[model samples]
Target: MNLKRTFGAILTILGIVGVIWGAYAFLAGGDSVGGVSMNQFSSVVPFIVGLIFFFTGISLIKGTKDTA
Candidate 1:
């Protein structure tokens, strides 16, 4: 398989999970593994990561083929 495709797949999955977990933490109010309390801004980290992965995945999946 293509390297880009592989990385893209991983990022996509991470993004989805991050967004979901972040939302859950935000709503349910929980502490992270390091004991960090979830809050309005703190809980957004996952969502941010998710967005990064989602966008990166899209970019990778739609990237132009190299002819070199």
Candidate 2:
């Protein structure tokens, strides 16, 4: 088992969940992004972080050579 790959998979999964949650929360809040209040802006954080996590995990997994 590749530890890095495993960790990457975990990150990817978390990223997916976070993105879904953030997008849903943000959209469901019924406020346009341009009109977002400070409190509403909080919902966007997960989305940005999720994108970072998703890309980081993907790169980590792809760049890591299989030891086996």
| C-alpha-based local distance difference test score of model 2 | 0.81
How high is the lDDT of residue 41 in model 1? Answer: 69
The CA lDDT of each predicted structure is 0.78, 0.81
Candidate 1 residue runs with Cα over 4 Å from true position:
30-36, 64-68
How well is each residue in 1-64 modelled by candidate 1, as lDDT tens digits?
A: 5888778878888888888878877876665533656866678888898989988987887793
Q: Each model's TM-score, in the order given?
A: 0.75, 0.81
Residue-level lDDT tens digits of model 2 in 1-68: 99999999989988998788778768767554445443456888989999889988998899899987
Residue 68 C-alpha lDDT in model 1: 50
